[model samples]
Target: AQSVAQPEDQVNVAEGNPLTVKCTYSVSGNPYLFWYVQYPNRGLQFLLKYITGDNLVKGSYGFEAEFNKSQTSFHLKKPSALVSDSALYFCAVRDSRRSNDYKLSFGAGTTVTVRA
Candidate 1:
């Protein structure tokens, strides 16, 4: 079964410092990885995705992620964190084994707190 695991329930980082949210996945074939951010009651907003090619992919809000095929991991990163960047994050994966459907399996969710 394809699944994603976010080991951290929350991440605390100081403003202007780098931040990272860990994510690992298990799948049968090449997985379509994505990172999404949710604020309050709003729906999740796409951050970035790793389909093919480049290992390092950049996305909205100056966020980036590195796809490590060897480790089966896709970790989100930001150079300088901001208080506004504080929100709930979810890591998702679309399993290739299931061709008929495009259901995204998401992590439980992780909250990022940026301290001023």
Candidate 2:
């Protein structure tokens, strides 16, 4: 089994500033980590994923995450913030080894507010 945690309920950042949403995970074996964003009243969208290879993975909209195996953390980050970036973000994880069942366990979610 695998689980993910988003420590912050919300994150506030000024436009043009860097923003980071913390995430930590736990699993039995190697883990596959992912980041998703949800706009109000819509479905969740994929951001980036860490399957293997590089520890640093880049995704859409200049967003990136670092896969820290030592700390069991996969934190999302953006070099600069935009007011349009305001939305709900979720961190998810699945075990490297899969069964017949395919499912993803997601974090509680973190609301990001970017102000002008």
Candidate 3:
């Protein structure tokens, strides 16, 4: 079974400051990682993903994530955070071992608060 974990339940950051949301994963085979953001009463918006390319992947709204195989981590980062960036973040993973398993297992989620 594959699983994802967001270490912090809530991340507080100041506007214009760098923002980070940590994530770790466990999978039997190669991992396909992804990051998503959800605003109030809205569905999850795709932020970024890590498949079989570069370790560093860039996504929407100035967000990026680094996939570290050694550490089994995919941490999301934004150089400068905006108040509008405050939302719930989720880390997800899909195991490649199971070709038929396209389903993604997601973390509990982390709430990010950006204060101006």
Candidate 4:
């Protein structure tokens, strides 16, 4: 079974500073990694993904992630943190092993709090 792990329960950052939210996963075959952010009481918004190609991938809201195949990690990073960027972030992996590959196994989630 494909699974994702978000080791951090929360991440705090000062406004204008760089921020990173870590994510790791276990999957059979080539993995499809995805990052999504959710504001308070809102739906999850897609951030970025790593399907193939370059190890470095860029996404929405000035966010980018580095895909490390050897380490099985796809860490999300922002050059500068913003108060508006504060939200609940999730790391997900598609379950390619199953017939219904649409299912996504998500991590526990990490809350990002940005302060001015």
**Poorest 10 consecutive residues of model 2 by lDDT?**
95-104
> How well does candidate 3 score on lDDT at residue 38?
95
In angstroms, what RMSD does candidate 1 have relative to the true structure? 0.6
Off by over 4 Å in 2: none
In order, the Cα lDDT scores of the candidates are 0.96, 0.96, 0.96, 0.93
lDDT of model 1, residue 30: 93
TM for every model, in the order presented, reads 0.98, 0.97, 0.98, 0.95
Per-residue CA lDDT of model 3 for 1-116, tens digit only, reads 99999999999999999999999999999999999999999999999899998999999999999999999999999999999999999999999998875899999999999999
Give candidate 2's TM-score: 0.97
Span of ten consecutive residues with least summed lDDT in model 3: 94-103
Once model 3 is optimally superposed onto the true structure by TM-score, how far is the C-alpha of residue 91 displaced, in angstroms?
Answer: 0.3
RMSD to the native, candidate 2?
Answer: 0.7
Query: 1-116, model 4: which lDDT tens digit per residue?
Result: 78999999999999999999999999987788999999999999999998889999999999999999899999999999999999999999985556654888999999999999
- lDDT, model 1, position 77: 99
Q: Residue 65 deviation, candidate 4, in Å?
A: 0.4
